[model samples]
Target: MTEMVKGYNFAFIDEYAKREIRRKVLKAVSIPGYQVPFGSRELPIARGWGTGGLQITLSLIGQKDILKIIDQGSDDSVNAVNIKRFIEATTGVFITSDTLKATIIQTRHRIPEEELGDDQILVLQVPYPEPLRIVEPEEKETRRMHAEMDYAKIWVFLYENIVKWKEITIGARYPVMVAGRYIMDPSPIPRYDVPRLNNARTLYLFGAGREKRIYAVPPFTEVKPLEFEDHRFRIENFKGKACELCASTDTFLDEIILDDKRMYTCSDTSFCKKRGNNPRVLKYIDRNQQ
Candidate 1:
């Protein structure tokens, strides 16, 4: 562990930066799907990693906030652990792995298996904030398309995918219509977590530091994944597979290979541990699904 320099502001980011970020966050929340540009300051971490999410977490976190950070749904992952420790050391905020206990969760690639309450806020680390980037690389053109609400290219791309694969081959970073207005990418979260974003009770804030963009999904707002009437959006099916540890069929499972033997386990380590110890946790997952 590196020794901290004496008399630094909380979370390592200066007060001015935090204030500016908060302002941008407010603007993002007001617009829902509109991406708000910000002056992204360089952090100790390099760009394209988690600098975006880290900045957001550091800005919003307070001494009283109970923070939880996870990568691919595991609290023990290297990125998660480092971010959690950094935040704790800087802000002196309490940290926990329990989803229900956390007031704020900063995640990469996954959302927790447990349902988040209205009081909780989810800060997602986004590598690419633009849904139209693949179709239109030019920022000015994409902005013009967004201004005119033109998504023909996006629709065409989806249609072509269906024509070739017979199904939407996109497994992650699924494009969605936010509040039936702007098209937004919900980061690279698995398709399983897409439904959780629909009219979610908790607020969702997306940050892309490398891109210097911030977007949000306010609580109870509409978020529909792009799909056609005949070709509806589908989640990743486990094909009757369940977690070997907790026997959870609904939660996302990670496959591990050991000595050529394949094993399945829950990706959300905390949820799996709780479920393994207490059978009643199944009810929570069921209720959340409803």
Candidate 2:
């Protein structure tokens, strides 16, 4: 574990603020997909960048907790790197890029390819909290819809997409019905990550600082992506495509153009290295503990 920076609290935020966030989190988990409002405290970072997810991480994190931060599945991205550095300096918690090694994983726009264990907690940074915003612009009306379980507007939106595009045109941030009650935007994670949210062992938490909403999908909870009988929801097909580096066929691949040719690579770079039997990533350990 890194030493906590001087003059800062264990997790940077005051105890009272952490307690309040914890209370909100409890309510969020209990309700399952209900967007519980909280006092989203201003962090050193900008609000839209990841203040929501960072607040939750700081609030729930412990000295012993091992953390992993990823942006769009890349560990070394600018956003991920900066957040990891900030968290490490503030909390003195151990950081790992290896998905399985992290007790709490904070991610923006992607879920790791590896299955998180029951002990793991996944904190997702949410830019938008309302799935009904596309259909209904008003918050009062959206809340009413959620209260009444009225999702007809969203259903129609999907239907219209199918009619116009011959398929559900939503590329990312696909809406899902959690526990058959509330429709939720599962961050901006790709359609490939949608099905992984259903009945997962790990608890999923969503925080939107700009929106001041925190929601959750507890382990084993039902999370069904919105679909129609005729136009069933499907994941992005990468048939005959494999990650160039890892030769992985199952994981989510990011398309890139190199030398005027299309190439696909694993989005989760650490996982890709692991697949290639690279010890560079796996060698990252809690040096203090070791």
Candidate 3:
């Protein structure tokens, strides 16, 4: 039993290690947009498998806290489900699919539909935290560029691309200027999640395990998605369609391709999977007749 116990619970990270992570988190919260480097631990989970998010969750989870997790906006997505199970197994904390019930949420790729309040905290798993990563491959160079707010190269690159392609030609993981100081990666969240970050009520934290960086956006921070005055900001969507399963018009819809029959249905799979029977999802449907 002693030998078996050696490989489990908190993995290889000692209590001191966790305390170090807690210290970095505190610094991240105190100085918004400033990157705090921490000694990241090797979890049982592999790198880029939401390891950063899991570390933040482990460090901050108090005895009484409800946790919610989502990947690409779906609770049951394999990565999200696995991470949720792992955290629950380690902490014995209750996990909820409902966004509102959660005090702490760790997410990848998408933000939830519900508006977050100041009481909640959102943790983002960032594959790459450096916004200047494309322009300067070396971490050392990017850090210098950020310190000087030298983004002339990024703007020139974008301008050249538009000149050649007749459009910006970039989608998802778009760069943004945070607090008009640091140019930050808003993780890989869809463009829809970009606007939601602007002056949001919730505290937002980003962690990159591979890079050993942690950062934050305090409540009411100015997060501007990279854009032009004439171009404005927008999110992609299927026009004039509602979810077939939940019939939600306002929710983000996933296009489901039905086999090779050339037929498709608009469905908000997350909503359908969560609350199909709830009144909010089924209000317009005649369930009794069915």
Candidate 4:
């Protein structure tokens, strides 16, 4: 067991791989929203299953950094638990379910409901980094289009969506124009979380292992979702629904079906737990009463 453990570095990845990733991360940060290419190493995990986010986490993590891993807003999910355990075993870093206590957060699908501070960093797992992939399959052509800021095709696609669906049919992975310069996918985060990425206090990094790309949204960067002037960008509307457990209306809720009875609960478990014990719940209740 001791000999097997000695075969791998602190994060199971070698120091050279970490340094290369760090260098690419710096470049990604320097030019926010620009997808920097890197040599993605094969981990014990499979690709298309969060190898990108895992690589990023393993590279940037330190002994002092408090890491939090979440999948679809739940830390207790299978993917989250596995990644958390892997990181803990390798780096010996303190792991936390509390969003506020986490220095580094690796998330898939959902962003935390609570506001992230400037000190925090969010690493998103991206299956695809290119927003124009649906429009153009060839990567070289897409790169050219991005270089010339030729998003006319994308705009036309959005226009078509309005004409066909009466609303932007993109449920998630909505494309956004980042920093008024480059167009980005913002990963697979829901449209509700897209607004949170705009001018965010925390640094938002995205990694796509299969795609071999890394992108970033630095603090205070602009991130405008693609939409026509007539058809503005919108988020998922719960239609007057509130979490059954927390009784909070101002949070993203997951619909729960128990015994054919539909109910809503906060998608973010840590945020829900915190808000349940917080006095702010009283304020929310009082405001509703008035």
The most accurate candidate by lDDT is: 2
- For candidate 3, the lDDT comes to 0.77
- TM-scores of the models, in the order given: 0.95, 0.94, 0.87, 0.94
Clashing pairs in 2: none
Please give the RMSD to the true structure for each candidate, in Å: 2.3, 4.6, 5.5, 4.0
Lowest-sum lDDT 10-residue window in model 4: 281-290
Please identify which of the two predictions, 1 or 2, would achieve the higher lDDT against the true structure.
2
Cα lDDT computed for each candidate against the true fold? 0.90, 0.92, 0.77, 0.88
Runs off by more than 4 Å, candidate 1: 1-7, 283-290
Q: Pairing residues by index, what is the TM-score of model 2?
A: 0.94
Please, what are the lDDT tens digits per residue for candidate 1 over residues 141-192?
Answer: 9989988999999999999999998998788999999999999999999988
Clashing pairs in 4: none
Q: Which stretches of candidate 4 lie over 4 Å from their true place?
A: 1-6, 279-290
